[model samples]
Target: MTAEDPTHPDLLQRWNATLLAARAGREGPDPAPYGHNLLARWAEPQRAYHTVDHLRAVLDRVDELVDQGGEGGELELVRLAAWFHDAVYRPDRSENEERSAALAEKALTEAGLTGHEVREVARLVRLTVTHDPAPGDLNGETLCDADLAILATDPDTYRGYAEAVRTEYAFVPDEAFREGRAAVLRQLLSLPRLFRTPYGAAAWEERARENLERELRELTGAS
Candidate 1:
């Protein structure tokens, strides 16, 4: 499927509905404003790769995996986690995932989700920071793979994603950003597996390695 247009009213409504359902029985503050706030955050000028479009891509991947009968049937929680995972992103901070997870816990709890469910969602949101899960961690594996799926896209698309990420960190000096980004690429390349899900491993591993290796070479000015 083609990339989704996050600006579309229908797409917004779809996500809004998901939020509302999370609190089906609860009488609370209007969730609409919360949804609006998330949209506004994603639209911030500093955000290039972490925009609503990225969220949509992740949600789409989740749906595709579910259709494919991948493990872990916790679809609702996974979807909710996807929405909140990057809700608090900031280029300068290392605590974005933690903050985002906390925000998810608060919002989801207020939305009437059970305490256990809310915590699970928060945990899933936090998992993005490492994107590493134990071998049997189906939800974690699936969500992590979906989040990084862009890494395995075709070269032109990967280039667009890489450039967008750089734009988000435009405040960093070129040399600093290059070194930092190259370090990140090297770390990812060193992983035994880039994606944990069976489908993700099959579809993304080789391509993701190729992208990271090439990008690392270019960033470090390697021959």
Candidate 2:
């Protein structure tokens, strides 16, 4: 959704709360401007899957993990990571994650977060490049699981997500897109565990695998 949309206000509020909590009473400039900047980034015209809706979904999934007793380290930091994770997405570019992480480093540092907090947030944002967080990395697991929770959605919803991703890469020819997308699916399927958090594994593992396999088969025309 665009910054002009109704949801913008609520998202800005969420951002404000998360930023304030992360700041821990440290003095900083008004957060509303930073929130606005991020919201506008998420609403960029080139995005289809990585839009404001995706941002909200990731944030919600992070909350779900915590509420369900999963190990979610430093909630406010995790939330900030979620916000910056895809804030600089471009389907055509491979450096999006690195750039997003850098943005988080700069923005969060300026927003009054301590060096440790900013580094953690940037590290979490970069981990999206490979959802496979090392074992026992609670914060990494939480953010990665939440970002990929989309894969465990109901069949129709999963299909819609795939379509949205395709829409983002519309510049790619269909055959090439299918090949690249199938490779991604295969890579994910090859992972020993798609959901690193215990709650995510218990609640979403099977469904996410089924969805990925189904989509892979469709993409490859496999029996």
Candidate 3:
């Protein structure tokens, strides 16, 4: 979605609120410009799956996890991390997560967040690289779970997600894409659990595994 999209205003409002709450009455520049910058990044033309819609979905899932008692981390930081998680995405690059984390560190620092706050946000952004938070890392678990919640979507929605991901990597040959995508599905299926948060584990884990396995079968031509 672009700046002219209908949801832009509401997203900006959400960004402002989250940033201010994170600051906790500390002084800083107005949040609107920063929101616009991040929004533009999310709306970049090359993005298919990691667009503004994904940003909103992740943020909403973060709220759901917190409200459902699935997460006990610092909500504001998690929200910020969600915003920055795919901010620097490029389909062909493997270093997008690290670049996104660096962007969070620089932008949040310039926006007047404390050093610790900025670092935590960057760390959360980088955690998307694995989506496997270490034990007891509440904030990491929250962000990673929210980011991967798409895997648990209904079959039709999950198909759309898979298609969008394919669109992002359109340069890849069909066979290569299939092989790579199958490998990713296998890796996820091999994980002991797909969702770390209690609510996610209860509500999303089974469906996510089912979706991954089904996709893997399709990709690999398995019986």
Candidate 4:
């Protein structure tokens, strides 16, 4: 977890393996043509939001949720959703959900996945946008919460993530970036809890709120 610590090879391998297996296990069938096309593009480095490292971070966060006892029986769907959630990320578009879902549909279908399975993954991926789910829908809530877990990270780390996101949109003016980023931090502070899972909410909620408060104060020169 420390900055100096290297990326763990085992963890990376396991995630890649999981994605491949889950894709291969479906009932309907893999769109081999599209599959070949998508896989080639998936590994290429991108400047904006779809960075490989960001995808890895999301998977790590999702695993953290599972370790903390996220809802059972929906584990694969959550993990698959996490992988595909930002696969087709384009910073300028408001239709990230549909794009990501399209990528998911292509992959799931090629893997012989059925309509119901593809729909489940697509729904979970789309859930990242709404974020708010019924109290009982632990799976959806956990994945969505993990996506925002950066709010609960240490201030310096949170700041780094903020910069990364901004850099992804380097075309934006400095003033615009500052205003937009500050607003996002404020929204997180306004939330009841940044994390929806019981343990994440209980253990990290207070720190996340504090981090957001500090960011807001620094932005407005109030503290």
Tens-place lDDT digits, model 2, residues 2-52: 535644788899999999988888899889999999988998999989988
TM-score of every prediction relative to native: 0.90, 0.97, 0.97, 0.80
Clashing pairs in 1: none
lDDT of 4 at 204: 74
TM-score of 1: 0.90
Q: Could you tell me how far off, in angstroms, the CA of residue 133 lies in candidate 1 after the best superposition? A: 1.3
Q: Which candidate would rank higher by lDDT, 1 or 4? A: 1
Q: What is the C-alpha RMSD of each candidate to the true structure, in Å?
A: 2.8, 1.5, 1.4, 4.2
Query: How well is each residue in 18-125 modelled by candidate 1, as lDDT tens digits?
Result: 766766666766667667767777677779999878988998898877777688646777888898899998899989999999998888777678888898899999
List runs of model 4 lying over 4 Å from the truth: 1-16, 19-50
> What would the per-residue lDDT of candidate 3 be over residues 59-163, giving only the tens digit for each residue?
999999988986478889999999999999999999999999999999899888999999999999988888889989999989989999999999999999999
Q: Relative to the true structure, how large is the alpha-carbon lDDT of every model?
A: 0.84, 0.93, 0.92, 0.70
The TM-score of predicted model 2 comes to 0.97
| Clash totals for all candidate models | 0, 0, 0, 7
**Which pairs clash in the backbone of model 4?**
28-112, 29-110, 29-112, 30-110, 30-111, 30-112, 31-110
- On TM-score, the stronger of 1 and 3 is 3
Q: Specify the poorest-scoring 10-residue window by lDDT in model 1.
A: 1-10
Q: How many backbone clashes does candidate 2 have?
A: 0
Query: Once superposed on the true structure, which residue ranges of model 2 sit more than 4 Å away at CA?
Result: 1-7
Better of 3 and 4 by lDDT: 3
